[model samples]
Target: MPELPEVETARRGLEPHLTGRRVIEVRLRRSDLRWPIAHEVRELLPGQRIAAVDRRAKYLLLATAAGSALVHLGMSGALRFLDAGLKPAMHDHYDLLLEDGRLLRYSDPRRFGCLLWQGPGTLHPLLRRLGPEPLGPGFHGDHLWQLARGRTLAVKAFLMDQSIVVGVGNIYAAEALHAAGIDPRRSAGRVSRARYAMLAATVRDILSYAIERGGTTLRDFINPDGQPGYFEQELNVYGREGQPCRRCNARIQCVQLGGRSTFYCPRCQR
Candidate 1:
């Protein structure tokens, strides 16, 4: 699945071509992706002028006068900007034809992506209760400390909670925790404020760096231009189990935490 940085990269790649452009055509190649494509999307999308392209968490918001088109690029989804004449591939499932003759195509092999609508003043359920954006001001050390006060969940599990903070997925969570020198299995409520502060900073730094590098491409992730991300080359311990740690030279270890694979350096992290 595309994490926040990958999704943000897609948003950045699409904004220049999408903003201020009028949607001349909208085609839903199938009726559903993850869930049924909403009727409002087919009815109100065409002829609407794109006011802005924004991202909340991992979802891209295409703002228009009538409503906002909400897009979530699930596991294998890729959105590409192509010339109007380019032929659609086998997985190409939807297209938005712009007045400028550019076509924004959505392709998903797993069909887990989503296209939904949100009217003015109405928040979609998936987005309504999400915690603050990890890259935003609202997600500081104090915020994490407060939410973590009484939770017995492992730190890794707590950090992955969408209600505590959004977009710190499995990859970034492991990276950030390793960088902060906090063990993933530590009890969340027992973590100190000072350590939480360190964790918060590492989270921001890791995410910012990944976004700058266009996100980590493990599999099936590409920028809107079809370029694979280069950040994977710089990974510390996310997938280097049984290898020497770059910082401490200790054998990197892997475990299953919260049903997700977790990698860490025993000596370097806690």
Candidate 2:
């Protein structure tokens, strides 16, 4: 599934092409994707001008006067901008016909993604309770530390909680924790405030750098232009299990935490 950086990249890539453009048509190849396509999508979207493209957590929003079209690119899903004359592929599920004769297409081999509607000025349920954006002002060490008090969950699991901080998924969580020198299995309540501060900084830095590098390379994820992300080459411990640690020359180890595989350097990440 696409995480924060990946979704942000898609938002950035789509914004230029979509902003101020008019949706001349709403073409739905099918009636559902992961969930049933909202009625407003077919009724309210056609002829609406796209005002902006924004992201919240891992969701993308196409804002317009009528409302916002909420999109979630689940595993193996992608959105692409293409000439309207081009033929649709087998997996192409929908398109937004633009006034300029271009189109924005959505395709998903697994059909796990979603297309929902959010009425103007109202928050969708999927987004209402989400924690602060990891890259936003509301997130910090103090925030994580405050909510983590008395929580017995593993620190890694706590960090991955959407209510604690949105978009710190498995890949970035492992990298951030490794960078902060925190073991994934440490009790969340036992982590020191100073260490939490360090973890928060690392999380911000890693996320910013990953967004700059076009997000981590994953089999199901590709940029709007169909390019693979370049950040995978720079990862320290996320997928380097049994490999020599770049910092301490120790073997990188892997363990399952919260049912997800976690990689860390035993010597470097205390």
Candidate 3:
């Protein structure tokens, strides 16, 4: 699945083309995606102008007067901007015909992505409990420290928790932990405040840089322009099991933590 940076990259690519444009049509080729398509999408979205494009965690929001359409580019999903006259491919799920002779297309081979509704003055259930954005001012060392008190979960798993801080997925978590000189298997409650501060800053820095690099291109992720991300080339520890560590010349190791593959350099990260 596309992480926060990937989703944010998509939002940045889609905003200019979508904002202030009227949705002349809402083309839903199917009745559902990961779930049933919301009725308001086909009923109320046809005539509204997209006011803005925003992201929360890994989801995208296309804002309009009637309501906001929430989009999740689940595994194998891609959104593209194309000429309105183009024909749809087999996996092309939906299209939003714009007034300017362009269309925003959604294609998801796995169908895990979703198109849902958020009425005015309301927050979607999915968005309600998510923690502050990792890049936002609200997330910092103190926040992590507070939530981590007495928690025995591995630090890497703690960082990947959406309710703790949104968008620090597996790849970035491993890289950030390695950058901060912290082992992925360290106990969340055992990590010191000072180390937590360093970890927090590293997470912010790594995520900001990753977004700038257009996000990591793992599996099916690609920017809205159909380009793969450049950040994957810069990875330090993630997916480098048995490879030499870039920092300490130690062998990179991998272990399962919270059911996900966790990677780290035994020497550099400790």
Candidate 4:
């Protein structure tokens, strides 16, 4: 699935082509994607000008007077800006025709993504209880320490909790914990406030840098312009199991945490 940086990269890439442009048409190639594409989306979207493109967690919000179009690019999904005359591919599921004669197309081979609507002033359930954006002001070290109180979950699992902080997915979580010198299996409640401060800073820095590099391209994720992210080339430990740690010369290790693969340097990340 596309995580925070990848989703943010998409938001940036789509902004110029979408903002201030009116949606001349809305087309859904199928009835559902992960869930049913919103029934009111087509009816509410056309003729509405896109005011902005925003991201909350991993979700992308397309602002319009009628409502915001909420998009989640699940595994293998890609959004591309194409010429109006461009032909749709087999996986192209949604299209927003723009007044500028361009089309914003959504293609998902696995159909796990979503296209939904949020009525004005009403927060969608998926977004209502989400924790502070990882890149936003509300996600400081103190905030994380507060949430960690008395939590026995593994620190990695705790960090993955959407209610504690949003958009620190498996890859970034591993990188952040490694950077902060924290073992993924440590209990959240046992982590000291000072260490939590370092962890929080590491998380923010890793995510911001990944977004700047166009996000990690481990799978099908790409920017809206269809460019693969280059950050994967800079990875330290996430996929380098058994390889030498960049900092300590110790071999990296891989373990399964919450059913996801986690990589860390045993000597460097303790």
lDDT of 4 at 150: 92
Which residue window of length 10 is worst by lDDT in model 1?
A: 24-33
RMSD of 1: 1.1
Candidate 2 residue 63 Cα shift, in angstroms, is 0.3
What local distance difference test score does each model get? 0.91, 0.90, 0.92, 0.90
- Model 3 off-target regions past 4 Å? none
For 1-270, candidate 2 gives per-residue lDDT tens digits of 777888888888899989999999999998668998888999999999999999998899999999999999887789988889899988999999999998899999988899999999999999988999988999999999999899999999999898889998889999999999999999999999999999999999999999999987767678777777878888999889989999999999999998999999999787
- The count of backbone overlaps in candidate 4 is 0
Candidate 2 deviant stretches above 4 angstroms: none
Total backbone collisions, model 1: 0
lDDT of 2 at 32: 68
**Compared with the true structure, what per-residue lDDT tens digits does model 3 show for residues 49-122?**
99999999998999998999999987778899899889999999999999999899999998999999999999
Cand. 4 TM to true fold:
0.97
lDDT of 3 at 94: 94
lDDT of 2 at 135: 85
